[model samples]
Each structure stands twice: as C-alpha cells, then as structure tokens.
Target chain A: MTFLSGLTPYFIAVFCVLVVGFWIQLQREKKPEEPTGETVSTSKARRWVDQDLQDDTEIPAKNDEDDDDDDHGSELDLPHVPYAPPRYPVASMLERSQDFYSLMNQRRSVRFISPEPVPREVIDNVIRTAGTAPSGAHTEPWTFVVVSDPDTKHEIRTIVEDEEEVNYRQRMGNKWVKDLARIRTTWVKEYLDVAPYLLLIFKQTYGIASGGKRKTHYYNEISVSVSCGILLAALQNVGLVTVTSTPLNCGPRLRVLLQRPANEKLLMLLPVGYPSHDATVPDLKRKPVEDIMVHI
Target chain B: MTFLSGLTPYFIAVFCVLVVGFWIQLQREKKPEEPTGETVSTSKARRWVDQDLQDDTEIPAKNDEDDDDDDHGSELDLPHVPYAPPRYPVASMLERSQDFYSLMNQRRSVRFISPEPVPREVIDNVIRTAGTAPSGAHTEPWTFVVVSDPDTKHEIRTIVEDEEEVNYRQRMGNKWVKDLARIRTTWVKEYLDVAPYLLLIFKQTYGIASGGKRKTHYYNEISVSVSCGILLAALQNVGLVTVTSTPLNCGPRLRVLLQRPANEKLLMLLPVGYPSHDATVPDLKRKPVEDIMVHI
Candidate 1:
C-alpha cells in the first residue's frame, strides 16, 4: 500500500509534465485566425504615427492633439491608405557594371576577437543599413537587442552556459557531439561575456498585448531570417567581425533572463567585436559557384 | 456492395496521398549525416587527379595510382589548394556610396506591370548577385528556375490562375478577401505569360540519388530566404522591378508543372520585367530606424 502511494505521486508528476508538453506542442502548431477589430486598428495607427514622424518636418504641439483625433476619425471616414510600393533608383548599366563584381566578391564571414569596442555610430549605421531589408506585409517583425553592458553580458554568459551544459552533457546524442567535435567550442561561454557587444536578434512571432490577445504575422521565420542576413551584411560592410550562435535549448532561458514579452522568440545570438589576437577559424572551404548555381 | 466498392477506392486514394505527404515531410526534416567508410578518400582521389592534370605536372599517372594505395598517403598527399578569392579593384566605397544610398532610399515594390521584356543580361546579373548569399555548412540548397519560354510561361499562367480562382472563390475567408480587395490581383493568367521571366526559387530540402540514399540539409528555409532577399536586392539595385507572388495552393502545382525533383520544394514565385507604363503601386512607407532598434 505504501509503495503504491509513493508511486502514485511520481505517476502524477509524469502525467502533469506530459500534459504540459502536449499543450505547448499544440500551441506551437496552432494557426490562429486572422486578427480583426482593435488589433488591425492598433497596427494601422502605429504605422500611421511612424510614417508621419519619419519625415524631417516636426508636428506642432497643437497639431499633435488634432492628429490624435484625426487618426481615430479618419479610420471610420476614409479608406485606409494602401501599402506604398518600394521605389528603387535606376543606376546606369555602365555604372552598375563597374562595381557590381567587386561588391559581390568582397562579402566574407569573419570570426575572431578584437578588443576594440565598436563605435556607437558604426553600430547605429549598421542597424540603419539592416533596416533596408524588405519584410512581409511591411510588418518588419524583428528586434535588434544590442547589449553592451558588462553586467548584463556576464548574466547572459551564465545563462547560456547553464543551458549549453545541459545540451552537451545530456540532451545531444553521440552523433551530434561527434559532428560538433571538429569545431572549437566550449561551455565556458566566454564570447558572450568577452565580446564588446552582443546583438540578440528576436523574432516577434506575433504581436501581443498585456492582455493575452495576439495579432497574426505572415511568414514569420522567413521574414526574420531575411532581416538577420541583411544585419550580418551591414555589420560586415563596416569591417566588423561577428559570429552567429544559437544555443538551441536556451530560448526559454533567454526569454526569462531578458524579461522578453511572450510574443517574441529568440532567433539568434550574435557576438560582435574585433577578432582576438591570434584568432583562427577552422580550415574550411566553400563550394564553388558552379556547384551551387543551376541556370534552368 | 456498389457503395462499399466505391468507398474503398476513395479510402485507397486518401491513404496513398497521406503516405506520400508523410514521406515528403520526413525527408524535409531529415539532416545530412557524415558519410561512412571510404567516401572521404574517394573524394580526395578525384580532387587529386583533377589538380595534378590542371597543374601540368609531368609525374606519371601510375605514380598517382601507387600514391593512393600507400598507407601514409594523406601525410605525403599534395595539398588541396583553393582558387584565390575573386577581387574587384574598381568597386570602391567612395564611388558606390551615393548610388547605394540612392537605391536604398528609393527601393519600392512594383505590383502592376507592363508586358515588357527585360534584357536577358539584366536578369542574369540579378541572379548572379543572388548567388553571393552565404549558406549553412556551405551547402547552398537553392535552384533558380527561370521561365522564359512562351509555352512554359503560358502553362504557369494557367496553373496560377486556376489556383487563384479557387482562392478567390472559396479558399480565402471573407476577411482575407476583404483585406486584399484593394490590391489589383486577378485570376487572369496574363502576368505569367506576359512577364519576361518568372524566377522560381526552389529550396532543396534533401539530396537524393537514383540508387543512393537521400541526405537532409540544415536551415534550408533560412538559407533559401536569404538568397531570395539578395535576389530582390539585386533586382532593385539594377533598374528592373519584380513582384513576389504566392498563389493559394499553387506550390504543388508549380512543382508538377516544372517537373521538379521530389526533394526540391518551391519557396517563392517571382515575376521579373519592367513595370507597365500606367501601373501604380500602394503608397507604403517604411518604419523609422529608432522604432526598429533597441539598445541595451
């Protein structure tokens, strides 16, 4: 009777975990209906406010109060403004030919340590460059969290290491461990701490409020990844080195550590700084263009 | 008895489709594993033979044969030298800065189009620019299928229109249909046939051989999307305009129309050409940098 009683608690614990896991899996897979009513209005209002302010002209304080009423009133009275098509400048064929090959060739992935801190202006410029990436429905569902604080860096390192340790020791099987063996990596998590700046890229899966309601986003993964690519290119163009790191099991840990809202999901952890003295990458080779490209 | 027999056929059809779909999903999720046994040596041998012939070395071919069998062959083996990375001397930051910024500032999406044929070289260069995207583990899992032949273009138009007709009629709910009502999209198949080129971006989820086993790729979706971003930028950087079109329930139809391999999945359909002379686009504006960036 006592043994049965003891096992009952354990069984109950197991059942609870299984139920929670299933619920999480279901939530991840569920495709929410398209958002309506206030959700659409709020996003529309935010977009309107952003557009009005992006121009150099400043609104007078008197106009600002009128603008607030206009925003709500216009929603009911007028048709919503259609999304503007992007307009790119035309470069002469000859001019484009001159530099096209060089810009294409100069792109390279850099990873190493340099102790110098990247200037705030340069970081700002790079972020500005990344903002040029095209997004789905122009929602631009991305957030670039640049961390330069020493204390926060240390905290991130500790959190990432804790999760990585679990991954390395228990979660990953032998095959995964073997594949990663060639690359020099450690649970020490020094890069998270030592790098002068850490850029945590978060993908807003959907828009959410303090209330549990959510707004739909289209092609969330594709949209966010495109933004990341542009960000990397922008950073590299400025002659900075960065390494993309994704601690697979550390997403939830990071959410808690960063006090992120539920709608945002951690996409990548980028460590940006100068390469260390004597920093060397693995002897790796990229596939040739012929191998990668197929003109059909 | 007749009813039961008819139901059996329907059940069999459903079962077959379910099985095929499950198999495809499984293949998509699978990751490539390291090859076992003598795969590495065989690849090395092939590379060595090609390198020696290219170098114009006078060493006897039999000497190479003997070298391959030697136990210490790896140590004494000729080094696999990579071709020098391409350089572009004329592409200076100063010269291209203005053009880059202008293009960046002016980039706009073009929806309405003219039936104008873009120059072949323009399309080629834009695709060439897309080829510069970096890949995961250097596995560039993308194939650009350019549709230019009249008959193929016509066939694509038919397929796309058929899908869009269904989307407009029944598939898309009232809300989605209402949201998209302002945009001038149609079930008419003219754009596919009229555009100079239809670039179909196919993501290779896995590699398959007639006799050999299939292998999976990592981050194929992200890699393909990044490449698409570059393609879009390249098109924008040049003077050509493009519209990324997704017809409802058309991916499978596209694969069938193109006679694509089972391992390849359609990522996007881009119609490339000059915009129609009278065409107009939605007046969309991008969010400001401050709204997008968060510094900690």
Candidate 2:
C-alpha cells in the first residue's frame, strides 16, 4: 500500500497524458475533412498532362474582383457605348450559319504539314482575330509566339521529341505496347520543323497591372483556350492545316526556348501551313448535333 | 529515498510515454504537408465560382489511358486515311483570313438582348459547328442544353438572379460598392428572361463506355472551352450575340433543373439573341497585334 501510494502521482500523470493523446488523435482525424493549405495535384492522372495548364499556378489574389466576369479589365472602367452590330435577315443568318458550319466541319487535325512558307501577314491577322476574344475583366491573357526561324523550330522540335518520347514510353505500360499499333506517330514531330510557322500559344497566369503589382487573370486558361478556338477557326478560314498539340511536360522548356516571360505558360502548339499533298488523317466522325445538344 | 525508489517504475513509464507522445506529435505535424484525400476548393475565389467545374469531382480513373491527347478514342483503333482538304492559293488565303478576322473582330458580348425570336435551325447549325471541335482522345465530352421555352428560361433566370444577388451582396464588402459604379449590370439579369434562347454548356467529366464502366474525359474542361470558342465564332458569323455568364455557385442547381447526367457539369451559360436596339457595351478596345503576338 505504501509503494502504491508513493507511485500514485506518476500513475495519474501517465493516465492524464494518455487521455490527452487520445483526445488529440480524435481532433487530428476531424481535421482531414477541412481544407488544408496544401495544394492539389491537378496533374495527377499522369505526367502526360501539360502541368502548366493547372489553375493552381495562379496564387490566390488578394482582391475578390479577379474571378468574376468583370470583362472590361482596367478598361472595365471605360464608358459604355451604344453597340449595334450588324443584324442580318433571318434567311441570310441561316445561310451564314450553314456556310460557317460547312467550313468548320471540314477542319481536321492534320499531322502532315506542307513545307510551303505561309504569308506572315496572314498569320498576323489570325492572331489578331484570336486577340479579339472576350477575357475575364477584359484582361487579354494570351500571348501568341510565332516561331518561323528554321534553327529555333529545330530546337523546339528536339525539345518536344525528347519529352514526348519519355512520355510515350514511361506513361504507357504493356497496354501501350499493344496499343502502339493504334498510336499514330511515335513522338517524332516532323511538322514542328517542316511547317512554316509554329504558333506557340501561352496563357499568362497573371498580369502586371499599372501599379506594377501582380494582377490575377481569372479564367486565364479558359480565356486563352477560347481564343485558340477562334484562332483555329481563322486558320481553317484560310485553308491552313495544323494539329492541336498540347505537349506534356514540355511547357517549361518551350517557354525558355521562346524567351517568353515566366507568367506565360504554353497552352497549345500548332504547326501552321498547308497540309502535304499526301497528308492523311484518321477518318473520325464527330458526335452528331443531336448527341451533343439537348433542347430543353 | 525509499519513496523515490517506489516511484521509479511509474516515472520510467511516464517518461517513455512523453517521448512517444512527442514523436506522434511530430508525425501529426508532417501530415498536413501531404494530401489527406480531401477535395480542393477549386471554387475558392468565392462562392462566386461554379464548384461543379472542379477536376477533383471526377474519380481517379483506373486506366492509364485517361489524360493524354491520343486524339482517337475507341475510334482511335480506326485506320488512318488520306486527307486532302481544300488548299487555297496565297492570295485567296490572305483574303479569307482578313475576311474571317473582320467578322470575328466585330464580335462583342452584348448584354441587352432583343426578345425577337431567332430561327431554331440557325441555332442548330451553330451548335453543329461547335461540335466539330477536337477533343482529348476523341471523347467528345460536351453537352449543349438549349432552352427556348419561356417558362424554363424564367426558372433559370430566377435561379441565376437569386444566386447572383447573394453573390453580389455577400462577396463584395465595401470595395464592391465602389466597384459597382464600374460594374455594367447588377444581379438582375433581364436577358435571362428576354433572350430568345439560353444555351447552357456542360462538360462531361466522365463517360459511360461500352463496358458499362466510367471513362475519364481527359482535358474535358479545356476541350469544352475550346468548343465554346468555336460556338462564339459561329454566333458572330451568323450576326447573333450573347453574354457569356458563368453563374457563381449556380451550376448544380442549373444542372438539376436541366436534367443533365451526374457526369455533366455546367462550364458556361450564354443568353443568346440579337442585341436590343438600345443595347450598349463597354467601349472596349482589344489588344493590338504586336501586343499579343511574339514573332520569334
């Protein structure tokens, strides 16, 4: 009894600690359900994703104004003006819609690009058209880097080929070996060199505002991508052929090679020129309009 | 000394427990650095973002084939065919580029839409044009919901307005009051009721394949956005107008209202029609060619 009494305080101390430890463990388990400061792996499926395209790169802006469609940007402060764009007659509108659909429908991602030099001014006009896309808060968050130089194109090709080879081999397992028969080309991008122009589309993750402080470009990826859609339409309008290639993990290397600012990450790379006379594409049918559209 | 000796074992037990507790605490501290499988708040910009649009909603696809631009889906197994699309001469190509640019550049987001009915067929052709956009691995991961019924449009408008009002009042504290002067429209969206058609674009994050298993739609959001870019160009081509509004936190409600599948998440909402006679847009100037393009 004396021995027990002598040891009683130490035993109580141990008991108290065990209770506290278990309580802490319960609290710790509850914490997993809440948001932590740790960032998400937006590139998790594999290294095959263009890791640069994730929105996590854009740090959370201090201002609440960044995410919404404030549209006008700094120019958002600009005055309102009466906007009366051309409104065609119903018949003419129908004709125009059908004509445009016919033209756009003919567009296919062609891998074999002709070596013929495209008119520089034509490329300029297409980029200009793309720039006209509406961005979040009028912050035009796209930079089109047109690479026409042969040596630079070769370097770009080399960088892409190296990473793509790694991606193709490493990303694919035994199934990839079986699917190799189904794979189009095994990472050899001849069009990168052969095409007259390599239009590298970069989305500015953030922009420097007039105060020279960083401004958040909200929906920057979507904005730049929408702009690319218009750019594709422009290219198709001029009968140019190029494949939309979002090179996996090659954004950093390409950004450096193109001497673009750190904020600009490559969203897409298009090799612009005519299709080779012998160019071939996989005969693919798009989902019919009914399959894609639901009348509610 | 005898009492102290009596307490020795208990003391040893207490000391050992504290050391273990310290080790456990150290482990607990380290855990927050790694992912706890908790979802990311992709909509953290505010409740203003469409939470449904986050990539985290899609389960981690078991197949390694999910993320890359394999271009051909199940159809990827199809044979490549010779492709000779129209080849325009240099002069014609230049002319076409200028023509298309002039048309697309005239496009703007006009908010005050005319109530006059637009032809349904024109909308169909425009959607068909949008459907022609290339997708990652040929998973045409887009659903366009066209609402022409006045009642459904009103319901949508009600849902959007309630959320937008909450969004406007709650999100902006004192600064939003100041920025409201610059804001074009308040939470009241008359165009939702006034427009001839409301097009809600959805991105299928996953698809039910032939095996009755889910397939990941890689780059689905980007794919849908690109398709929208084409949709916008198509609208512009037909002399129609729309204001691209991504309603903050209104996606799930709208999704349920539209009866879209679980895999479909709202990416964009456009109120489509002709601009009202008195419609006015912010007198906005796009970035010039040199500003957006880098000739390397």
Which candidate number maximizes lDDT? 2
lDDT of 1 by residue, A5-120 (tens): 97785567556545654574356348444323223443242222111001111112222222221111111212222223343334464346335534654554434556566666
lDDT of 2 by residue, B1-296 (tens): 99999878656655654565467446646885332222223232112212212333233445424433333234333455567788888899889889888888889988889999999999999999999998766678999999999999999999989977765554433223323434355789999999999999998877776655566666787788899999999999988999876676688899999999988888899999999987767666787788999998
In terms of docking quality, how is candidate 2 classified? acceptable
lDDT tens per residue, model 1, B124-218 = 66666666676653457787888888888888888878877765555433333433433334477566777788898877765442334443344
Model 2: CA > 4 A from native? A1-77, A172-183, B1-76, B172-183
Q: Estimate TM-scores for all models.
A: 0.65, 0.77
Best by TM-score: 2
DockQ of each: 0.09, 0.23
Residue lDDT tens for model 2, A1-296: 99999978656755654565467446646885332222223232122212212343233455525433333233323455567788889999999999999999999998889998889999999999999898865679999999999999999999999987765554433223223334355689999999999999998877775555566666787888899899999999999988887776788888888888977888899999999986767656789888999997
Q: Which stretches of candidate 1 lie over 4 Å from their true place?
A: A1-101, A177-189, A208-213, A274-279, B1-102, B182-189, B209-211
Clashes found in each candidate (C-alpha, N, C closer than 3 A): 22, 4
